[model samples]
Target: MPATENVHVWGDARPLYTYTRYIQNHFGERVQKLAVDAGLSCPHRTQGRLAGGCTYCNNNAFNPSYCTPSKTIRQQLQEGITFHANRYRRANRYLAYFQAYTNTYAGVDKLRALFEEALQCDGVSGIIIATRPDCLPESVVNYLSELAQRTYLFVELGAESSHDITLERIRRGHNARSTEEAVHVLRSAGIPLGLHLIWGLPDETPEMMLQTLHWAAGLDIQTLKFHQLQILRGADLAEAWQHTPEAFQLFGLDDYLEFLVPIVEHLRPDVAIERICAEAPPKYLLAPNWGLIRNDEILRRFEKMLLARNTWQGRCWRGEF
Candidate 1:
């Protein structure tokens, strides 16, 4: 017999979706751009050489040329929209995305000013903040709750893995427990959350990766993104990889799918799966050239695997093992 879809108490995949891309498909005629840069750095990295940033971090590695600090927060937003508007000509709405560094790593009052400035923008529709789990303060949570009540708001946490050892190996400076606690605290506020994870990390097996997905499924997050670990152009990881390449196990195209198939099955039915992978620019990528493949090709293979097994997302999560 075929398995039937179940309705979830937390409002599973069908009725309400958390992704901005998914929402744009339904309501808006044109998608808007939001850009925010508050001068924030990870606490681990702020001390300079002690903890340094994550082994795989270079803020400029992925930073768009459009994102510049000379401009105020509001000026950055206008510039981002202008760049997109010239091409689309019809998109009028925007969401202010606080992307660079750790957006929440500041005083509550300063954070409030940055957020409020974006909300006041004429075409701005909502806000999406990208920050590490450890950086989100109580004041930030309360401030965001009020904003969620008034306008669309969500937070993205860099909870990259469930493996504590991997966390230490990467010098993440925060544990899986910290991520869980942060998620729990913020969930009570009712703003949607987006969790970021990387598929290929050093010392993690397929089982470990699935465990991360299962853990994520238990959360109240609205969306999730899976990124393949890219050894970027200027990242500290690249230097390490040169000396001890065996420390990393970068996946070929097929090996990554092997890791992902069960992840799709085990992830919560309610979580909106956003990007399956990040496209690392060739010039900046020190390894893992498989990112050159398109997202659609990967999705097609994933869907094929699901159909072949006659299983879909949330299937394993909802059933007996």
Candidate 2:
């Protein structure tokens, strides 16, 4: 198919449902997303569940330098707009990404204040609040649902994995049940839902990870991001892996691409794939250096592979769960 032609199921030229294409199709314009650190701490980290955070967590691995919790929301958004200005010149509109820590862990009133502050920022058309499933109380969901009616809003929940054993191994402090309940509540309230999942975790086999894709295919999620776990410096998982190296099997670049191809094939056609891989700066990364490859390059290669094999998302999908 030509670039001008749209794939019927995906509604785009891409082999898979892409977030960029989805945004373009919906907004009819380029929409840039800016990450903001709202200074909110996770209950699992601050409330005595985990001393540091999830075993594999190192916020420095992904957080932008411009995004610091110490900065006020207005200052952060200004810096973010400036930072992304040169890169995304075509994007006049932006979505404030409440990315660092659990964004919805606070009380509903406080959460509203923070969200409203971001929404009020110049050029910001919507807000994407990244949070844990266990943190979305009924009140928060109700409030967010009401807010969604007024502006573009999204709630991104970190599911990490669909398996309880993997959740326990990562010290996630929540189970798949909590994720399901949260998804149910958000979907019931007509909120757009996004989920994040990590493919490589300690003791998680390829089969186990694919099973997670099968599990997520049944949900009301509109978007999904698949991150291959990157062991970062100063993270608990790094120390543990060093001590018991055999306990985990890390994926090299090719290995990960080959491993992920089938999983994508098994995914539902409607779930937009926001990110197929996660990249960290070389300074913070500890293993599996795939070079400083940009996401576009990786995605181009991924789609080429799919085309070469004559396969696409949902090619192997089965509704039976």
Candidate 3:
């Protein structure tokens, strides 16, 4: 009678492969991700693919002050561990997250050195490499497969939007085909895959946003994360919104909740949702002000909304529907 019966990892409340439960199930204890900047630069920024990186990007908006590339990997990991220990006391283990720019755009030898360094750090159980879809050359994919056998590793690709038009407008510099190819290559290499997508980009309607989930549900990826577009200071997106304003439709907290609830039903149950919302520092944020609510509070609100409607994840999954 209870939906939790059908779920193994995080129970009915989560409705998807929660990062917390997944780490616990695999490691026998909770593990937190310590994001490290690794001082990596993207081809888009340096090689003139687009010029100024993704239109929505400003690495400082998300990176903690301690996560500077100037510091050695060992130093960054030690500081991140301390920060998390004070904030999330439940986690005794960590996954070194290479989150800045295109982590894999560099040569395979450089990537290997950086990743191996993280793996050797204290309390780090594994590593998560966040990269662009266009950067995963065959050599990198092959190397990642080898690394997976030696240590726990996951590669997260930024597939941002499913629509090529939207990707172009946002200066993603890579198309949907490249994303699909990256997934196929990673799947073949036997590497665990994760995807990062953004909702509410300019010109994307609510219907179009839901379609991204439909697109993702068909993928073989093991984890997924979603964030609403945040027009942070110094971003080209913010400048564009400031000039046109009418061209974009940013979602306020309540509007986003209404939009997100039904979208969850359409996701593949096996795909874990890492995050549904993200917060930027108040000084940098420009619009759709949601006040100072933390991620946990927002998640709590989402759970309450689901129960009130009696809906669940994968309710409208392809075969089930």
Candidate 4:
């Protein structure tokens, strides 16, 4: 079974349904829509570092088939809605999740125009813009904040980790402070915010992960996604893995669960936990493959273990359970 957030389903513990709940709460309706990719490349990829994207980022890994750069915005929206609506016939609404590369790297006027265009689509309810923290401009921030006052808006930044060193090691280009400042600016403007976090980055110790979680809890972030760092083919991480495979310790299924439970508990209960793991294709995954067990399968095992051990989200955090 795939893990669901319904406490009744989990029986003893609560699994969270993140973005779904947040959107419903924000718009006061069920948000059973598809995330449409508006193909965009960040300036960081061209105007600067020119490095071959982030080490782990291959937008190809996540974008759905319905999302094609060649498709018109309307055509893409139609395709996405068709697929999702067929599966969930009852839902008639959607949020245009601009989720390919960096959705916020463009000029402010362009972002405003694209978002406005998305809203013009029939049945569309809101916008969810995903981008790198360093790439979100102040002008864009101001514009989005203003829009949120009248419409539902969320900005999910790839603040992958809290440590500067790990960011540099991953060729993330930006530092911890950039993420902190991004959240501060957006929150100050009254825009709802979401963040991306990777739990097992190379060279980051378990102690550091706990500290990072604590730091994350202290932020004004409203939502966060938890992901295990996965090494992808053709990524900078592939090269690192080839050279120092022994130096890296990939998490076995149970070990990763143990690693995450504490961080989850340490996290503020109010911050909606979006995703527990990054579900990559089997062909692309390198190791620790549990043969495609559903997310709920993992969650069931996790909750059983956590409870058997008399632990919850924050057990043994800061040397206190």
lDDT tens digits by residue: candidate 2, 116-142: 999888888999999999998888888
Error of 4 at 194 (Å): 1.1
For candidate 3, lDDT tens digit of each residue in 190-307? Answer: 8888899998998999988888878877888888889889999989888898999887889988889889887887877667778888888888888768898998899789878876
- Model 2 / residue 142 / CA error / Å: 1.4
Estimate, for each residue in 77-133, the C-alpha lDDT of model 4 and write its tens digit. Answer: 888888876765566688888888899877888777778888899888888888888
Task: Kindly give the number of clashing pairs for every candidate.
Answer: 0, 0, 0, 7
The TM-score, computed over Cα atoms with residue i paired to residue i, of candidate 1 is 0.86
Give the runs in model 1 whose Cα sits over 4 Å from its true position. Answer: 1-30, 48-50, 86-90, 300-311, 319-321
Q: Relative to the unseen true structure, what is the C-alpha lDDT of residue 198 in candidate 4, on a scale of 0 to 100?
A: 87
What is the C-alpha local distance difference test score of candidate 2? 0.87
Worst 10-residue lDDT window for candidate 2 reads: 1-10
Q: What lDDT does candidate 4 reach at residue 107?
A: 83
Model 3 earns a TM-score of: 0.95
Alpha-carbon shift of residue 214 in model 2 (angstroms): 0.4
lDDT of 3: 0.84
The better-scoring model by lDDT among 2 and 4 is 2
lDDT of 1 by residue, 163-182 (tens): 89999988888899998888
TM-scores, all candidates, are 0.86, 0.95, 0.95, 0.87
- Per-residue error (Å), model 4, residue 291: 1.6
